[model samples]
Target: MRKGKWGKALGVLGGSWGAPPELCPALTAVFQSLVYHECHFTNGTERVRYVLRYIYNRQQYVMFDSDVGEYVGFTPYGERNAKRWNSNPGWMEYKRTAVDRFCRCWYKTFTPFLTERRVPPSVSISLVPSSSQPGPGRLLCSVLDFYPAPIQVRWFQGQQELSEHVVATEVVPNGDWSYQLLVLLETPPGAGSPTAARWSTPRGPPEMPPDAARSKMLTGIGGFVLGSLFLALGLGFYLRKKVRGGAGGRVPPGPERLPRQPGLSGLLGVTTHANTNVVDGRKAFIILSHGFK
Candidate 1:
């Protein structure tokens, strides 16, 4: 096989692919040979790693790691191949320049495209219901529907970051180029007002402010309380009117006959029950029930 040049650099790996198949007559089996490049982005842009690798039968055969700047072999056959390939001046020069020629050059070209494809995760936070830890609330922070899975989710109380009690889920692939994750923050925030702590994500939008969230919750509670107060006042007025009307029309507990007030009872949404005692020669007071019609 004629050795060409050691050149070319990455896409994703993020994306990984192999070379053409080679037939091995000694074993009467076809062993596939593969070649691909990988770009690893780290915390520092200066620390990005570019690698050109070769494979045989799905095992690593040889590689030109940018950090190492040479060919490395993982197997005996690969060692012989690497030694022969590394001996050439053209191979060395190509390997050395591949970082600048392809890695950095294409890296700059493709970075904006990657950035354009970046999908920010949607986040929501809720207090985790725990019968055991009811005193200090546990928060379940749901981070959902995102792309380019690498992300960091954190908890913060005002400007201070809370690291001790934070918990997170593995970046779960949603099977359609999207991802989901669930992070949990334990206690601390629950010790004070609902606005005592907040959540944050460096790669995502700023966490919902604790104060804003508290305000929304308080607004809902206030509306509920106001509605209940109005309902109670209306019910009180209705009952007061019914009582006054019944008292004025009712016959006293004397020897007078008890007249049925079915029309008034139906109108008042009440079920009326009364009894007259022959032995005592007195009429029992009427009983009104809202439960039964």
Candidate 2:
């Protein structure tokens, strides 16, 4: 009976692609609640994924039709490390692992859709100040959606249908087969109300910046950074070894060569005088005084 209830609840919250349409309202509420919690904060996708994974694992959900093959069941807990079925971990472990894997896989598959479709962005003002100031209000909020086909953008305030004031001012075509809608609002205080406002869009609210779309990009690059760090360290070590020891870590200089002196004997082509010297084999020459001559 408890299992049936869980199944019903899951049906409402939503499931893998083939989930049946006969889902109970309670089940739908569960999915709604998941969106409510998941979409309210930054990094909510990660939390939602983790929650879905937990639910799928704990529920022992079947991933595929039994007609395709044997109906493997789920094991919530992981397998014992040593227990083996012909070198493979036993059946229970395998089943549990499969469930865990599917949990991760399905979360990856559906969480974004659930987030995009379910919550829809809400740009609302908590309070509006008087038109006494130049600005529209304390904060006049708006939301722009770039959803693909079958999804439309609409605006609501306090559950009343706002038609004339609301406008689908702009539709920008994205290369990715999506259309962007810009919704605008001008909230200023009126005679009695704390907040009063209307919507404005020549085309629509400004498109969300590309940076906003690329949230969590750094997390993806983290693995590459680790690998690069290791490579750099290895190269640095090799270079240090090649350089040997020196000031400022530069390579030490090699042995110096003696500078060649000018060889007067070779250049002048004079080997010996061939004269017997008086004291140190010197050649004697007589010179007359030029000036006197």
Candidate 3:
């Protein structure tokens, strides 16, 4: 049925659409309507529901319900409209054919993805000051970024489950097909309250997807750092022992402390004076730089 006919009929009923009889008559009136559909896919079968709501000058006037299969009125003006429209057999047949022509076709064409996507939820528990609430402090548990709408949440104080003065919100849509939920526990303000939250799905909560990957990366980095530190320490000890090589493991002397050999200082034409003498074909020399010996 055309909406223009419905609006014009309500206009002739004389402005009693939830307004008083003494209400002023206007030369122009605003009429609006909302048409919406609910399509469902269940067990491989599709179902559809169609609704149409009318608003006359900002007041709710009438609506057409699929369950009733006809128009239902809200105001006096809309009641007269429903009676007139239901009497017409031609118009009533059009409304009956809407299930196949409008709602069923809409369900088949648009609602192929009735099944919701699932994602694991992340949870956090915090103790926050609450001036507006009855308790001295509130333990707030937020379950974020989950899908499929339905989830389970709980609050715990050590091994005990808490229930009193608990406030929880309905699942809030994040507009990107995910949902969030908040649960808060009321407690007396104090330190050292070990509160926690458990967020689970119907099947049980999976491990956090991002945190699992991050933990692996952090563990590998820690192992690499420890291995490098031990390798550097081992190399340092090996070099120190090589540099101090001798009979008693002493560092070698500098050039100014050398005792003159028979063919070395004269062949290079460089002379170093050290107390030396030959005794029974063995050279005896004095040490110079570190200490005289």
Question: Backbone clash tally for model 2?
Answer: 7
Angstrom error of the Cα, residue 108, model 2: value is 20
- The candidate scoring highest on TM-score is 1
Query: Per-residue CA lDDT of candidate 2, range 1-293, in tens?
Result: 99999976676556433365565543432332111111122374333221111123235332222122223323423122212321443654444444336555665677566543322222332333646666434333333333332323333332243444443445565565444445444433222222222322223333322222233344345545665666666667668766885332333333233333322221211111111111223222111100100
Segments in model 2 whose C-alpha atoms lie over 4 Å from true places: 1-135, 138-145, 187-293
Local error of candidate 1 at residue 184 (angstroms): 6.8
For candidate 3, give the lDDT.
Answer: 0.55
Task: Output the TM-score of candidate 2.
Answer: 0.19
Tens digits of per-residue lDDT for model 1, 190-223: 3322222232223323433433444566666666
Kindly indicate the candidate among 1 and 2 with the higher lDDT. 1
Clashing pairs in 1: 12-15, 19-34
Candidate 2 yields a Cα-based lDDT of 0.35
lDDT, candidate 1, residue 264?
25
Q: What is the lDDT of residue 40 in candidate 2?
A: 21
What are the C-alpha RMSDs, in order, of all predicted structures? 23.1, 35.2, 27.4
Point out the higher-scoring one by lDDT: 2 or 3: 3
